[model samples]
Target chain A: MDILTISLVISAIHLGVPIILPMLGGLVSERSGVMNIGLEGMMLGGALAAVAVTFITGNPWLGLLGAIVSGLLSGLILAILTVTLRGNQVVASTAINLIGAGITAALVPIIWGVDGTSPSVPKIPSMTIPGLSDLPVVGPLFSSLTAMDYGTFVLAIVVWWVLFRTDAGLRIRAVGESAESADAAGIAVVRTRFIAVMTSGAFAALGGAYLSIVTLDVFQASMTQGRGYLALAALVFGKWRVWPALAACIVFGLADAFALRSQIVGIGIPHELLLALPYVLALVALATFVGRTSAPAGVGKPFVRA
Target chain B: MTSTQSPPRRSRLDNELRAQLAVPSRLSAGGRGGTGFGTFLASLGGTSRSVTAKIVSFAVTIAVALIAALPIVYLSGSNAQVALQALIGGSWGSPQAVAETFVQTIPLLITGLAVALAFHGGIFNIGVEGQLIIGALAAGIVGATQHLPGSLLLLASLASGMIAGALWALIPALLKAYRGVHEVVTTIMMNYIAINISTFAVTTGGPFAAKTQPSATEKVPLDAQLPVITPGTRLHAGLFIAIAVIVILMWVLYRTPAGFRLRLMGANPQAAAATGISLPRTMITAMLGSGAIAGLAGAVQVLGVYGRYFDGFSPGYGYSAIAVALLGALSPVGIAAAALFFGTLDAGAVQLQAVAGISREMVSVVSGLVVAFVAAQPAIFRLLHHLQRTVLAGRTARRAAAPVLPPPINGDNDLISAGLDNKEVL
Candidate 1:
């Protein structure tokens, strides 16, 4: 194919990876009977943590670790509120989102002595595959892939396998489908949910770190934007499965890439309208196909011990 | 826990579930033999036990939020005492400060009510921010272009705004009611779409863009602007409108048949459906009503404050409304109070920054803390209960064996159950 096609494909994958991480995170948490609308917040927390740690340590790998730790903490907060306290998952998640936004925005000035955007920090370098770099057309794409991008791809497979193949996966699905029955069957519902949610947080934070350290190397307040919500839409579009969700993320990423490139491509549509393409598409997709897919039966409900 | 009941008599099970869920005896668990007062407060739609508990919880929530900010402030190299002083002085120290606080309160009060209404009906209308934007855009376009008399133009502008907001909400409402799509996701999507649409309308070369200000529309006609209530302060007649809306909403929520249907539908969809209520219709109406109120908030901001629609005019007032509504326990009076408190925080932020060298984003942290505390109310209640039990037990051995009270009202159960029921509809 031509350079334009190859570049578009590469852009889509790069854009898709951020969303895929969160979607996978959400998938794990939801599969274990927890509803995490706070993925956006967790992702934001991760982004900030990554940036702050990298700024202090001058190491992108350490920044990635910081993001994961931040995400896990966010997940723990959600788990405590929703699981132990039996609070409304959605409300707790909303609170998490607000706190994520507020804390990140609040700390920006404190850390960098600046507001809105942080100073640029060191970013993760892209990896070059020796054999793939020699390919004719798509070599550039392979050469441009970062470690995080490859990690995300592998992570997706691990998530899918853990969710569907292993004994732990079965327990999660069982709890999600019927927490009461799962408890009766000797599974620890609350523990399973807590772990799932924390795992979700770590994954989501990794996604946020990708934006800061891997992609931009600078953190902006609310920079995750609505990618967290878009990931939710993608999850719904994918019917709460692994492969389909990943595909859905790719579709959204493609839409995002097109919107970005369309200005240069001189599409007749206004740039403002172009920016709205992904959300519009999400709305359409949700309205049309959401009726067919079923969420885990016990999702959203607090599992109160009898 | 009650799942073992026979399926043949589902209504009875629903009744029991409603009784257990609706009456928050646990809120009054701190007081021995306080079930009567708890039931009375619950009947009056209050989320806490007595007025005392409500006040105490409110104070604690604020205090905790402030204390939580202390460490952050210290870490930021700002003096906590100075920050506190500035926050107070800016929000309530002088008449001018009070007026400014009210300025912030107006939109929050309106949007908080909009959010509370949807929450009461078991719908999470997260798109209020988007609805407000669309409303403001409509009001701006109409107020600027209309050729009618002053009063007529103002009315038309406000009406157009409400219509725009309702129309915007219609998509999510229909999708939620008919397709079982969750409004949380759909409304959020609408918010992004609204932001984009507004940006397109006001940006340079767009339809409503001002020649001098590319990111904002032309000012509305003088006649269309809200009349100032105070001579020097920016306070306007929007305060009165906000109050009037609150009174009307309270009546609608507590005294009307439609309101009863809404509450019933929220409390238990099965029971509501059994009582001949149309679930989808009620959901659609509640969502539309929420959107209209949210729209009015935007219009009021345009006419009363800015006098024109500007890009990014709202600093997430819609999202903040959720915290306000929850903190207010979804009650109109409570929401008004909560909005006033949040308004104080917002108004004080500027002074906090000027005097204490702190960032205005500090207010967001406080608000976030408040919401987090509110979300964990059950745990707070339990902690209070445990403390009370220990103290009471120490005072008298006889009271030590008293059984645990029932759980506090899970305010979000209606939302979860409503979502579940909606999915089962199609």
Candidate 2:
């Protein structure tokens, strides 16, 4: 029981960080009606950039910031496509994903000064709350620290609040539901969409930062792997509402935890099958809600002034 | 907001854009003409388009794409001159590089053609990757274990790959048809499933795994492997087969009745069904044919290129094929050219690394830029329409007799979106 509990908690923390950061990213662009398929690439690019930057600067915080900036740049390109040019969101997103894969594979050598692997670096510092420190299993939450772990919880609630309670949120949703209506109502649809996409980049970058700083302390090609896809699935499974989306991400986190525990406990299951579980479950959940759930309606489509 | 308030001439450019870009969905069905082969021909060559017009339009598009590529290349390097030299040399510089370019393009062209076919038939076979991986594994295993004569073994590998690809697609096809589960999501999920399964069998438990590359399956027997088309280059016989397949596709698409049915279904399945076309049989066949073509792409990759199955040998060739098929405008001839073009880029990537000192990531950026350009074609078309209309208005005012402008494209209409142009090879 102790083994299962500890394994579950670790897996949740591991999978949760990747999912939550990307979820924040997805929430941004998706909320604004741009389908950010390039989240995978952004996460990946950020992951590699973080490791490389950390290795060079020997500063974990700088490395984390570098990852965020890289993601922002990727999101910026996406903004250029979906916002300025009003191109197909899905197409632009796919291109970005490909860019991430090819870019990371190529940069791995140049940044690391090695063919495949990079030098290991120091980790991000973790902190615990003063009074909450002596608590049981939850007290050690601050032990294996990365900067984004604390930020994720804060951002989730803040973003949810900013999305639902603020005037900016109203305008963003208006742009998503009907750009024409939004434009007539004096909302800057293009500007809002662009900001939303840029914010998405920052969030996805944080996900990458979590990996380089908190998760592994290094990077590899496509290392962000299909976690980006799972986050997207979380967005869909959540029906695009922020809190529900986070909840969906937690489920994926648990599934990831399940796989990790199976591995640690010698479950005798194949690694391939274990890795395949989250995706399979994602598909099942997605399929169950396939036609039932609707996206922002304008998602994957480019909006133009009439 | 201020732009809309400008003078008519300036705002008229906006008007021209707004005018040209109407919702095609708004076109009432009353005056709609039949979209059959007769319409296809009329739309292709019998309308307002002249050879000069076609040539000019295509040239302008290519020029714009290249011009857009300039900034990207410059940003990719500080030493632009060296980058250019390396880019050209590394990609087209050596015989081996050129061979590699063409070699890589073969499976893409074939798989792209398959995708084009199904998309044209209005079935989205997005599971091409899953199908491709399975096909490659099946044939690789067959080629490695079979003791048959060399020639027969080659034939068997190809068959097994095709069958495997076809079989992989069967479930999604059924789900889409009966369960009403959209093939897009189902196929994407299946791709993940298929990839994992293939990885598992080849690495740990698959019956035909090798001892040397214990992480992957065994290589095919030497005799069963594809012969080289070019004696000194990496280019293999797969190129010839891909070309032959393209020719076969063109003939079937334009000449055969079954081809007629596929096209008919593609244009409008409901209408085709109303006219007595068999929806189920036609749908199933189109899907199977698409699977087979994608399967062929896998067979060639394993037998002609890799000679063994490993994880991710494709490097997204199946997905790239989708872009190729669309860029080719879903024609067999077009797909071949697009495939070759993409092949050159993949080839140039190595050159970028070797000569320009630019990483492979920049090549991906270039590719994304190209696709971005392709997706932005409609917008570009609108821009061109504005330019042409303005120019024509000037010319006609001076002459007192200008020809009427061509109609603008409606973005809302689902007219041959190359994104959905999932044209693997239909």
Candidate 3:
């Protein structure tokens, strides 16, 4: 394959990892009946935490751990507000998003004494599988990805197994579908929801850590931009399932990759138009497909015991 | 003091906290009279007792917000005292500062009402950001390129903005009402599309490029510009116009039959439908009204402040408006107050950066906290009421030997009960 196509495929996979991780996180949260629009906020906080920790410790892995911890805390906060307090889920989630953005922006200036961007930190090393290196075109594709990118692929399968093949998964699905029924069946609704939300936060944080420590190696204000929202849309478009959600994320990642590649390749299409492709497509997808798809039976409702 | 802090009193305080926590769940289950500033404002515009409730609720909200931000200030390595001083001095210390505060309040007031209005009608129209952008562009293009008399051009520009905003919102409204699509998702999509289209329009040598600044559209003709109300500040005629719009909107929402139907639809869609009110029609009307108001906010920004449509002119005014609406408790009077509060924070942002050595984005922290606290208001109010009851119980027991009349639960509840379903408020 030519350099353009080779680079395009690699970039698409790299870009897809961040979105895919979050989308999976959202799937887990939503599947357990909590609608976590706060994924954006979790990712933002995680991004900052990853950079700040990496900057301090000089270890990318430790930074990733810090990101996960922050993300999990964010999830805990959301779960408390929504599940326990029974606050409006949408409002609480929006608050999380705002808090994420605000705290990150505030800390950047305080820690780095800078605005907009953070100091560069160590990036996670890329790795290639030994046997996969022997192939021609496919070898480079498998070899070029960062470890986190490969981890994300493994995460999808792991999440699928945990979600479908385990007793915990059954309880989560049961609670998500009908909390009353789940409660009747001896499941702990609040505990299930809390776990799902926190786990979701962890996954999203991993995505965020990838952005800073694996993808770009630095944190910037509003760096995730609307990618968190994009993941939510992908979750919905994929009918809240794991595998289809992966496909949807890849498509979005491809759109992004294509947009950037087109700009570089000097394609005749307007850069603005290319830049707009992902959003416009997402809008179209939402208008047509979102209405047709069925969400969790108790997606946005706060579960209260009788 | 040690005596007052006895075990019984401590247990009572714990009881009060639990009771407060129970209020929101109770409110949610009761299906009416939910806790929100919207309900508070609805009561504020009512009888004397309700007005008092409104006042108390508003005060408590402010107190809660300040307390919430205290930790952040402490974490920032500054005492609360200095941050408070900075907040006050930066927002209202001087005439210039006050004028800037008012100027910042204009768009916020307009958009806050916009969000509040849709919210009052049971719609979560998150696309106000998109509406503002499109509306601003429409007004900017019309005002800059047109060669009509000054007054006519101004009116035309504002109208174009309203029309454009309404039109843009119409798509989501129709889809939401007819197709069962959630407005939050669709509107978010629309915001992205709007931003993209606006970005495309403002590119160098693009169709709407300005003569001097290619990244911006031409400035509105001087004749069409809003006259500055203050000498050395950005305060402009749009402030009065925005206030006027707020008043008119309040009047329409409170006094009109259409408004009654809209509220009915919001509060109980099933009942509204049973009463022959068309859900789709009411939703569309509410969405259109919201869009028009949001558009006017954008238009005023262009005509009164920027005089041109620069790329990314708004720094999330639409989003901030959500906090403003809730902070104000969703009454016209409340919205006015909320706008001023946020305007002060926004105006003070730069000063906070300079005086307290904090980031200007601290306003967002405050806004976020306000949103979170507002979400928790029912519980907060319940807690406050419980504490007051406890204190009053203790005082009456020791001092007068007189039976204390039950503290009137906020009269705000009755107003909400009469008009809205609390569940629909979110």
Candidate 4:
């Protein structure tokens, strides 16, 4: 294949990394009967926490840890509101996003005493498996893959296994399908839901950390830039399954990568119009195919035990 | 211990489930078994109980919001007392402050009502932000021209804005009403598209780019500008228009048959469909109406405040409108109060930054906390009901032990039977 083609493929995978992580997070949460519309908020929290920690501690790994913890806390808030308090899931999720936006905006100035963005921080180094790195045409992509890219691929398989192959998966599916029946079966429905949502937080935060520590290495306001919503559209496009959702993320990522390259390569299209491609595609996909896609029965419904 | 502990918990769970289960005795649960005052309140209007409930919910939400900001105040190392005082005094201190708050409130009130209307009809029109942008662009383009007379110019500008907003909103409305797509996702997409188009339009070398500003459209003609209400403050004629719109909305919602259909469709779609109401038609109309209102907000902002279209003119008015609608309990009167409150915070932010050493972002946190608290109203109600029942349990213990209950449950059963019998008409 041509060098340009190989380069395009590499950029697409790299772009897909952030989206794929969040899509997987959304999948786990939705599959367990909670609609995690707060993926965006969790990612924002994670991104800020990750970058802020790396800036303070000078340790990228510790930054990742901070991202995960903050993301989990954000999800826990969503879980408590939607599950325990029976708040409207959509409203609660929107609140989470606003909170994330607000806190980050306030903290940026507080921490850096500057405006709009943070100073650059430590970033994760790319690694390549020895044999894979030696391939002819695809070698560059493989050799340049960050730890995040490999972890995303491995975690996708792990999530699929845990969701489809394990007994715990059965309980989750059972509760999501019919909470009353799950409760009748002694499945501890609320507990399972809490775990699912928190796990979702962990994955989504990893995606945020990937954006900050691996891709950008700096924290900026609104840095996620609607990727969380695109991840949601992917979950819908992928019919809420792990592998298909990841594939959808790749398609979206390709669009993003193409948009980026098109601007650099002097494509005739207007830059603003080019930036709008993923959102437009998401709308088209949703309008055309969302009806055919089935969601979990208990998704978005607060399960009240009688 | 287990017996006493478990029973209260179980009873509380039952109380929580009662409303969701559509229990026949729901009204009495709110009214405390129909004391004379409870019955009077229940009979005053179909929604009177809900009105009271909304008031209580909003009060609690505000209290929670104030408390929620304390941690931030501590983190910022500012005096909590001074910060709180500044927040209140800055928003409402002087005549100038009040006028500035109204300046912010005018556009917000219109958008908030726009959102509340769509939500009332079970449509989540999250594209208000996008619609507003397109509306503002239309208004700006029209207002910049000098082809028409004074009144005509103003009318044309505002009409163009409304038309543009409706057209922009129509895409998601059509998809949602006919294609069974979720409006939330579709509208979010539209917002990005609107932002892109608006940005492109105002950028250098773009169609509407100002020769002077380079990044904004030319200023609107003087004739098309909304008249100022105060000499020095930013207050304008848009406040009167917003008030007029609110009155009209209230009249339409309560006095017109169309409004009843909208509310009925929202509350129970199955009943609405069975009664021959077309879901698609109602949804489309609601969306269009919502779009027009949102469009007016944009036009008002441009004509009254900016006099031109600039890139990123809105500070997420559309997103903030959702919280406004919720905090206001989706009522016109409630929305006015809520908008004024938010307007105060928005206008006061500048002063707040100067005096209290707090960021304007605190208002966003406070608004978000209000939404969180308001959305949890049902849980609060459940807990309140549990407490009320527990307090009354001892006095009515022997009477409650009897199988037959008093008038409230029996009256509710009768009412439920009547409702079920004529469910189709309802």
Regions of candidate 2 where Cα sits further than 4 Å from its true position: A1-3, A52-58, A130-133, A145-147, A289-291, B1-24, B27-98, B118-127, B146-150, B170-188, B204-206, B252-288, B348-352, B398-426
Of the candidates shown, which would achieve the greatest DockQ relative to the real structure?
4
Per model, the share of native interface contacts recovered reads: 0.57, 0.48, 0.44, 0.55
Interface RMSD of each: 6.5, 5.8, 3.8, 7.3
> What TM-score should be assigned to candidate 4?
0.90
Report the Cα lDDT for residue B189, model 1. 92
Per-model CA lDDT versus the true structure: 0.83, 0.70, 0.78, 0.77
Residue pairs clashing in model 3 are B37-B329, B38-B329
Model 1 lDDT on a 0 to 1 scale: 0.83
Cα misplacement distance, residue B98 of candidate 3 (Å): 0.8
Q: What would the DockQ be for model 2?
A: 0.37
Better of 2 and 4 by TM-score: 4
In angstroms, how far off is B309's CA in candidate 4?
A: 0.7
The alpha-carbon deviation from the true structure for residue B192 of candidate 2, after best TM-score superposition, in angstroms, is 3.6
Tens digit of per-residue lDDT, candidate 2, span B1-426? 133334554344333322222223223122111122212221222112333443443445445544555554554553667766776676678788788888878887998898888766656566888888888888888888888999899999999999998987876776655544445545666777778888777775655668878757787887889998888887888888898889888767755667767765655454556668886788778888888888888989888987887777877777677667656656686678778777777777777766666665565555555556655554554575567767777877777874554233332222332212111110
Which residue pairs clash within candidate 1? none
Among all windows of 10 consecutive residues in model 1 chain A, the one with the lowest summed lDDT is A289-298
**Residue-wise lDDT of candidate 4 within A224-283, one digit each (tens)?**
877888898899888888887888789888988898998889888877777888888888
DockQ of each: 0.48, 0.37, 0.47, 0.50
Q: Write model 1 residue lDDT over B139-219, tens digit each, in one string.
A: 999998878999999999898988999899999999978887778889999999999999999988888899997789899
Worst 10 residues of 2 chain B by lDDT: B417-426
lDDT of 4 at A1: 100
TM value for model 1: 0.90
